[model samples]
Target: YGPRTERSKLPRVKVAEPATPEQIQETRRARAKAKTETPTLKIEHKVPAAERRCTVCGRTDLTTIGSGKSSFVNEYVSSQLVREEHVQEVLRCPCGSCVITAPGAPKVVGKGQYGASFLAHLAVAKCADHLPIYRIEKELARKGSPVARSTMNELLHRCATIVEPISKRLLDLICTRDVVLADETRLPMRNVPKGKSKTGFVWTFGAPDELGGVDIAYQFANSRSGATPRKLLEGTSGILLVDGYSGYNDIEKVSSRRRAACYAHVRRYFFDSLKTAPIAQEALDLVTALYRVEHEAKEARFDESSHL
Candidate 1:
């Protein structure tokens, strides 16, 4: 379906109930299982006992077919979120002196209605997957966790507020690395003034060799200025890889940072000149040869630190 026009009411996700003693014991005894690399969800449809009969002359007798044939086709499974409702106990003195309520689960956002898992799912779907909020809203409605798009957006903003410190810490750590690549892209602001649209830039800095699954920090600005990148490259005494952007010149001037130009940008100039000038073909050929050597080296498991 196309974009939804009507403001539909969203249904709340199913609340989790308190587990029984037996169920709790069973859950505690459960062990972690290794996951399959290939497709694991194989839904096999079996013939019912009442219908498992010979097709010839309505005969009821049939021999075992030894695990009948199965055809596999990819299918979609909708994800539904469940809410964990914690029912805390309340204690009061007989003399009505004081009352106390038991503590609940840790909050991702203080006193937040949604759980951390729900907030994480929404953040990944929107930020990582670039899924539209309306589509996410519709998906939730289709699955049983029907949450309003507005509510989801609000929760995401709150989640961001909670994660802001973590992101800053990651970015600070990345900046301290000896090598970092930085790039920027234009972003269209949706909730800007209605008369005219406003544009912002999203800058990302990554230290390619940095591990431990932490991401590079990003900075967002309304204007594309050298200050935005200078701030990101602050205290970066190592090499900085970037595209053909003069904004980073200030970074090289102020700091003892080794600025490395991207080969993709260098090749693009020759690539565009190929149509107008024939001499550019030789440069393109050399670039292609260089890329082939790099590819070969990668196939041979060669890294920057690898010798020979």
Candidate 2:
């Protein structure tokens, strides 16, 4: 036999109703704010005089009315590489004894040809979009600016060096928070030996505020050892919400932080045990009830004290 198969009914999920008039207007205002938040160069289009005339009456006279109807159209401007020529005007005294020149243009890297904007774009493409250097080079070539892959790699390293301080500052800010959540995931790294790879762990730390805003930081380590969390969260004291990992326990013992186990992990263990242990089903039912209560509290906008 290949395998056992069974058919069952799927659970139904509730669909949200359409927004009220007030909610719709609020959404429109928020969208307008988002649309205008960016710095944009606007180009206005005006109706030609001939086209503005009344077509049915064939009259050129038109009455000015209230502000004309308006709509917003989003457009993407393609990236183009431009050669910026900086001309510094040289000034000299009539006696020719002293001379001065305009200041030179600033660059992302000292004496480097690439501008700060270009370097920032490259960095965002590589890090945020996960584009390889070779792929980025091909894209630049298609845009009429063919740059060497090696040169792009060097520039990326230089950009990373410039951004390191800002990243450290963000990490420091996250550490100062009262509550933090952490997790780790495995990442494969190419090893020195040909056709070989090493498994590494990428630990993530997140600090979430009451307003649903979050700041996250990541640390990459070769091994998922207890010392990794200890080093990454050094000097940080708070409530850590994480899965039941032994490594975190070691950190909790050494630091002032307290470890709070994830309820989802407990639910998962009970769910898995249902296969062999029938009593696990009762635990699952209790967990479901707890979640339902939590959902009701959220829907009613209950605060911590109100829920208590």
Candidate 3:
């Protein structure tokens, strides 16, 4: 009776209503921006000289006027390949003392038959768009420029060789950042042995970019070894954010390099303990708040703004 009276003496309190699932989802969604259908690459269809004349009277002479009708077309233009022949002229001195020749066309891959633009298209098709080499060969053949599959394979290899220095520079820049995120994922190599299988891993290092993304550089290795990361991160002095992988443990050996916790990995532990401990909910809530803050900052374009 005393306990009931004490409970009744307490003031009445009300709890705020939890947001509906629909409202929560609405808050999390990113609204699409209104699109302006303006195209940068526009091809104008000019009237031919023969058709420029008056159609009804067939008059030869006519004053230039505005267009009779106009309409816009949304189109997908297939890329085409063109053969380029550079003609260099040689000039001889009047006294027959010396000869001079015009500079030849630039070599993208040491006198390679294909131009840089063509090679770039192939690289983007393979790496960015994930198109198979055989598919690319067929597409080009349909477009009237049939290239051999082996030739494309060699061209892609040469392109990778040409960009080796750029890859190193990108890694260097990533290392210069105060905080770097690193991870590795398994992928199968197509060049494995005929009978036995081989597993490959692509380790990626990431740095924050102005476009609200993590600018990443990656390397392919056959094994998930600490030595790989040690070699890749040589001369690096910064904190690394990565999953609790044993391969990254070598980074702790270096006095200059330190390891930081990955929030996603940490959150998983708390989430798994939700059934056992109620206090884990608080930790999960904090992580959710952190993610919300990051989303809001991204929406505000805070990353695009410069500090210096």
Best by TM-score: 2
**Pairs clashing in candidate 3?**
none
Error of 3 at 59 (Å): 14
Best by lDDT: 2
Please give, for residues 88-163, the per-residue lDDT of candidate 1 as tens digits. 9999999999999999888877787788788889999999999999999988888777898889989988878988
Clashes of each: 0, 0, 0
Higher-ranked by TM-score: 1 or 2:
2
Per-model TM values vs. the true structure: 0.71, 0.77, 0.72
Candidate 3, 46: how far from true, in Å?
A: 7.8
* Span of 10 residues, lowest total lDDT, candidate 3: 1-10
* Residue lDDT tens for model 2, 1-308: 15434222222333334556886787788888988996677566777876988889988888867666666777888887899999999999999799999998987888899999888888999988999999989988999999999988999999878988988787777766888888988888899878799999988888975666799888788898878778767777888889988878787666788888887788888777777896777776676667666876665446666843
Candidate 3: Cα lDDT at 94: 100
- List of clashing residue pairs for candidate 2: none
Candidate 2 global Cα RMSD: 5.1
Alpha-carbon deviation at 228 in model 3, angstroms: 1.7
Decreasing TM-score order of the candidates = 2, 3, 1
